[model samples]
Target: MRGVSADGDAGLGIDLLDAIEALKSVGCAVQAVITDGVATSIREDRRARGLPRAEWVRGIASQIALARRESPNRGGRHLGFAQALVHEMPHTLAMLRTGRLNEWRATLLVRETACLSAADRGIVDRRLCSDPAILDGVGDRGLIARAKALAVELDAAAVVARHRKAVSERRVTTRPAPDSMAYLSVLMPVEQAVCLQATLGRDADSLIATGDSCGRTRNQLMVDLLFDRGTGASVASGVPVAVNLVLSDETLLAGGHEAAQLQGLGPIPAAIARQLVADAVDNDTETSLQRVYSCPQSGALTAMESQARTFPKSLRQLIDLRDRTCRTPWCDAPIRHHDHIRLRRESGATTADNGSGLCEACNYAKEAPGWTARPVHNPGRTHLIDVRTPTG
Candidate 1:
């Protein structure tokens, strides 16, 4: 054969794209049929028994199993996934039909919008996929980011409420893995998880740097510390690992209902947090309390800097207590550095208002080409740092 002709290869690729588009259209049509069938069966069953319309899709597990040939639980995800596209996100559904969006992309739209109201989701679908050509080459990451950004921009309040509900449902679980390993999952609020990881890393780093040598790598050391604590044994390094909690004075002193935030974790119930604070004060000689004042409307906290004006451990603690995590939006990494939102060379003050907590990665990323961050002043709202990316 002559060397594969580039023109012929390009033609074949175009033909494959056409075939995939046809498959996507067929998939959407088939899903429509399956959904209608499920609805028809549910309606007919309800009519025979005089059940209400609201209850029609409630007890659908058996019918779903019989029709879909899968577990009802899995079937339900598909059913709801399909229904959402058909009803709320017709623009996205149209993209699926036109082969501009694949099955997974369409599914992603449904998933990320699960927290949104039907009307808001429809708005997002119309905004993002109204013109199917716009989604031609957008990967999953871009699609998700676009969807989430739109959702938050349109209705930050709703997103906040959804997050609060999710936080309430956080839990921990475990499962077996390959090679006699196990996976331990702690599904808690973002801040809590960040704090735990940061604490472990801090202890591990300290041990690695000590005059006494530990041959184990940082990763290995972290695991050892985790296991030692889990098994009720002291960490071998003998350096105290402290986790700070930022509690409101009202909650700490008067036993109010306001939940205190654990330094690395999110909110803890007022009563239990108070008890922990009391225990710490009584037990730990090194425990020092920092008074934090927060604005009533926005809950943004501010604390006074040290008398020496030094960015010491105390100053780091203050920023951590104030920001609670990295100041970068959507990046919840624990605060590893106190950074100036305005660069020092540009006359950025070193005061609390001009300072923010940022993880090391984000801190470094801010210095990368075309990235800029500066604090904004909003009269009624808390101070915000506006970050502009290279793309922006």
Candidate 2:
């Protein structure tokens, strides 16, 4: 593998293709192991506890998540894919095992056939994957379109039902982006999403035609219009929203070069923070400042304590500021739950030191058996948590 990098371009291309095929084989082997493990565990649980299948499967995904070093949501999806390939889609699995189809393409096949019955799904899988050469030139979209068409032909009613269920799952979400920007995404029905985009474009075009766009490009004007309409703030005027900007006294008062943290987003330049504050003031927007003192050396916020079991709003905010995101290692999801590092039933006090910010899924996954989290002391000005998973 290392020598492949030193090869000529033609040789390198061949080596790369071989490497990818090898990876696909490895992925297929891993899926087989996961499927076997799940089956074995379920059988053992049923025999030992005489429990229902649903009860036996509880917390299994959490164990898989720990073993795979992924979030529980991803673990569940993996488990589902493994089951589908092992039991229902044998043709697709065979193609994957032989490296004719990669894991992602196999997953797409499964997803597109999700609305079909087992028999119907098998037919689609066989039609699409039985001859490995048939998929040689097929792209992702082409494979998905073929599988979807087959699924619809097999069971149009099931496809319509799946669409209805998917519509119910539509939601809006946000994620941090590069350069202190953030991506705001909406998952809506296709027609509604298209109409919203068309509306924004039409308005932006009208503004451009009227020469009132203040030299902004059409795309820029469309984005600005979205912001103004969403927040009820005029673009020509300052923003009226209450944005939390966490900065040091040195940065805010003495022109220090340190970056400022924006809540729900990440860090921004100190200059931009100051300009935002100045704009708010100039526009006479109502603004209030609450002092948050941190250690000069370590930059850790001062600890706050409470006797109540539930964390107070102020303490929750402090934890949010301290952690910035989910505390689970490798999971950068935004904090949706203020979790107790130590359980309250075990005498964990509602104090800043014992509090941690976590995403909702991670918080729930931690409640499974054999998962433990505790605060550990560190000499540096940073909060340290020791988490032990069942596999560990």
Candidate 3:
């Protein structure tokens, strides 16, 4: 039995070099696929087998994410996790190629690249192509240099942003979804909302419920008002101004403003904005024709009322202390309003333990669900802030 000669060909002619060559070929083909775009599914079953383009791309983004520790087989992370990264590209290539990112940010981009699959690289490239931060901050030349540097380091395994990853981060930038209804909704409802609305306007509508609160936000419409006011508020003692008039190229030139966008507030000039303010003040207009059709939804309306009202006496002191800042670490959002971890309508106690301070951004994340302020232990003992990474 010991002499059965179990090995094939008595271990005679296995070409190890040939096997290595084959692997190199396979890697090359895969690299091409990653660098180029993939056609959308022409057949449904094809879609079923592989991850959807979005999901596939997202899965490959693992490179950008922190590699798990104490896992089974980890050694500086083999390239097994992500696909598109083999090509060293991102959804926002043009921006990345421009040196818009700082050193810390370059590493962050590398991590993002780790998550994309070969098929998803095209998608990522397009998404990031025109990112203003990449172009403006990192600059095209800088991004290209960084991209080249990263290619050597990561083999195009991850994205490179214009800023450092350590500068600030969000939860929803890369993940699939975000959690909402946490903070601001629980506190200063109506008037603050009104002020925010007046200050930000249409852009507020586009804030994704559970995503990051930065980037070229859909809130440009909202910010434009602030920009207009920022440039000229001194003339009116910082009171909210109103503007009413048809905006045209001529008007834009007259007001020292230009085109801008985010998710909302399409476009209007500073001069026109000021003119509208003057018109509103002169007429004592509470609502414009558009306003009649643009009233807050029942949910926002109710929220506005509750927020405008005050923090219950029992909760005031608690809110004042725990939330000295926005409660979202690194965010300096003022605690203008007190919010309950759990809202009143949900039968939450109107007690000190139920309160904390939050700025508008965090408020949106929690307000909908009405956070659990206290029960087993108070919400503030955590002395925590809401900080998460972005998914999309």
Candidate 4:
């Protein structure tokens, strides 16, 4: 979308998005060069996050430099994570200025657009991820804006989840300034926080605030979660495995440095762990699973889709408005993904109106009768509110 010669010369700023889109039209590689070049030159800086947009430009520039060397057709060789970084450019710049969005959210945007391969990863890093004008040409402007907003909300929850975990683990560090030590808050909808604690095997902290600074690190935070919640005497019914889960929860929940360990999950030992979860089965908690299984989504292969009559979109939006921290109504764990109610292949209409989001355990607990079957009162939209007073 920048400077291209009247003689059909390559534009300086176009990236693969421009190149590939044009290739579909012109059927030429040179045009790909022209378009791709124009896409990579300009970059935007998101100042609030302290990340400069120039890094993108530099990344793309590196690709251009490489192409000028070995691959004149501009093929082969990856730009490493730098190219992978291309997916996040727009949101990163937007987030730096707002502080409302973060890195993981920004990266989702970058990767979503990275389906094209005309530009090398190196080039993508420089051209598409770097340039300011690239976002202008993105299709479905409304969709892009809406998706970004959703990602921001999700990231905020993750941040809070991490913070609370940190406090529970004693990972927080402290240093006094003139007035006070710089404190961090893990803000969450009380319901979500409550659910996360249960998933981690802790009891509850209905009204958690910014505790000491030592709760910042991940390992410490998770350990603290276990210690704080399970500090009291162990009951006779409690199994050692349950206590171990408490330990694991603490180890996993602590945020910041130790988070990677939690995320890098290895194979589950099928013996005791599986038996524990399997034996845990008899209690039944399918409310959350069934709710999610009943929802809809974008990945559908069908003909006669769910067409809303009265309201264009279905009034029941499960994802937008969660009913509980636990899908089973009383079980625990923050929702991770949707468990389609109607099977995707059964010609089920793909819409949020058809399903709900749920955690894995509750979602898979269909062995018990009525496990996945819940009494969804009203079956449609009606405002539900609690009479409880605010704690936070």
Candidate 5:
């Protein structure tokens, strides 16, 4: 029979689907063969020639990266899977070669059996991978459950030891995000995580019941309280943690639904912004306001000017508010410097039009070889800048 056409023509729908599935099966078989070859080469080279593991892996990854146009991490993952299939899980390799098991499924077997010794892993591979029909209706979650049960049954002590080791490595990490926001990640015991979540929920409910007109949502209140407690800010003592907000007079006074920009954070309900302002003003908390004008069409700000020419503190604050985060494309790092898009020595004006925010890494990356940056003033878009790299 003639194969399906490249475009959506010249075959029945079922036939086209069958052809696609056949191609995918062939591709999996091909992958298994290639991986086996690579694994064999690595083993032979490492044993007979005595290459170090690190150097050999780097060499393999470099070759794979150049050939496949993939990152070294991806190459390393492929090699890892290859090594597992060749040495630890021959039955898995057979299933993969016969197109009965996909890469993800085989990888799952490898990952779930990681706590097992090589001999135990081989036992598991033999049991599960011997017959494809046994897993006919099993999904990823089901497979994981079945595999985990088998592993724990096989080596209960090993599972307990692995769990105890993982508990010792628990930690909290912070990652920056767009709009002056950051993510706080906690890797802890399951019970501890649940307790932390429940605590946040209880405090949020209590705060919401207090009945301020602030219109802060439950999630918002939880976040605020977490920050408040973490930073040791006292709401009762009138030393609440600072939250910056930008609001217009019309939205604040007239109760308009126009969203307000929370500094470093993105947009929030105008009502919430108004309530924050009212609470701060009523409590006599330290607050500052600036009048910012915007271009009507693009909604970008007009230049904020200063006569001192060294870039005043007010100007720095203005740039921070305008850009919110690093101006480099795809970079969400918090703004660390108020920089001239066109270099100061290159006759760039010390106005908002020429100023942008950049994090330390990106700001210095601009000074690297073959990098150029400058502001491009479109009539409607006043706060536009362009950055170029060596490649471009």
Candidate 6:
């Protein structure tokens, strides 16, 4: 049986390699389709009226997103990569077609050389990827480092411009994780990020040296210090800002085991929610409770109304709580707009049933021609919306 197992394992390894080669072939075909589709869209737009070529190209990404089952933003990136590979980085694309390079490594090459002009990019691509042997043992980071060095040699000014542009785009974001935890990410310039980490490490070491570190590990101490410094709360568990905790009366009052939601985050254990409330009370933190009326059986938020066209702040908060994030399909961006599912001018009321939470981009996209959205009714579900894109 052991000998048979070894033979089976060898066959499985061969099959896995074949599968990878097939995936590489599919990736090449997908890129070809994307570039050809862009050309076709531009030619068709030239024959049409009113719509600019750029606007027509915008819709192409959405259509590609639908076909690929991806977000519109990711579809746009895919289109950009396809255009670069087909028009500028032919050597890298050819290597991808030959299965010498995978999609991710090819994307790294394209990204690292993005600051270079087309001619310079072509030069880098030819030097790095012209022969399969050039990348035989190189890993992702090694490939990126080599590509960056070539790009700097070809045009250092463009690299400087790219760094400046990237610095301007620094931001902080959060996402939920498993085990009732969440990740907070800061996207800053490399120097700033490195400095921040070093500062945290230094502080954590000093705390450990003081011999009152409370048995926490170095990484844990760094995290706690980060929280305390960011919030100025002295203690990591102290609440320095408003935190909206949504829990049912049964869960809060009785010993019900239902999950509760923390706004901007996702579901947490009911026990943890009660613990947070208890801690707030014990610490004498100023807290306020607002009643959020919901159907007892279905847990859907009760409808709130306004006579005005625009949503009021309270109603907007309700919509935000109800939706938790953008209502667009597959787009979980934090809600930035309280939208009327049906246009207000088209007889849509300013009420909870008619309102939805959408990110800024999704809200603007919905306003474009041929895009439509409406409320969906499901007896036991929370707020639901049906959105139809132009392609649909």
Best by lDDT: 2
On TM-score, the candidate that comes out on top is: 2
Which lDDT tens digits does candidate 3 get at residues 233-303?
Answer: 43224334332232334333455454211111233445545555455557555534211111122211011
Better of 1 and 4 by lDDT: 1
User: For residues 37-86, could you state the per-residue lDDT of candidate 4 as single tens digits?
Assistant: 43333332323435554433333322332334422112212232133432
State the lDDT of candidate 5 residue by residue for 71-141, as single tens digits.
43455566677677777998887777666777788788888888998898888888887788877778999
Q: Which has the better TM-score: candidate 4, or candidate 6? A: 6
The residue-by-residue lDDT of candidate 2 on 1-392, one tens digit each, is: 56556256887788788877868676775776576577567658655876665555655665666667777677777787888888899888887777777888988988998888889999998888889888889899998888888888999999999999999999988888887778999999999999999999999999999999999999999999998998888875877766788998888889999999998888999998888888888888887788987876789898899998888999999998988988887667889999889999988879988999998878887875557889887745688889987557
Show where candidate 5 strays beyond 4 Å.
1-22, 25-29, 32-36, 39-70, 173-184, 230-392
Off by over 4 Å in 6: 1-7, 21-25, 35-43, 52-54, 378-380
Ranking by TM-score: 2, 6, 5, 1, 3, 4
Worst 10-residue lDDT window for candidate 4 reads 383-392
Assess every candidate by TM-score: 0.51, 0.92, 0.25, 0.19, 0.52, 0.90
Which scores better on lDDT, 1 or 5?
5
Task: Kindly list the per-residue Cα lDDT of model 6 for residues 1-392, writing each as its tens digit.
Answer: 13433355888878776777757766764676566676466547644857654555545555555566766676667777788888898888887787778888888988998888999999998998888898899988899899989988999999999999999999999999988899999999888899999999998999899986899899999999888888878663469688899998888999789999898888999999998888988888877889999876778888899999999999998987888887766667789999999899899999999999887767776765567788887766677788787667
Candidate 4 segments exceeding 4 Å error: 1-320, 345-347, 367-392
Clashes of each: 3, 0, 79, 56, 1, 0
Better of 3 and 4 by TM-score: 3
Error of 1 at 185 (Å): 2.0
RMSD of each: 23.5, 2.3, 22.7, 22.6, 9.5, 3.4
What does the lDDT read for residue 94 in candidate 1? 79
Q: Please list all clashing residue pairs in model 5, or write none if there are none.
A: 179-264
In model 2, the Cα lDDT at residue 231 comes to 82
Candidate 3's displacement at residue 242, Å, is 28
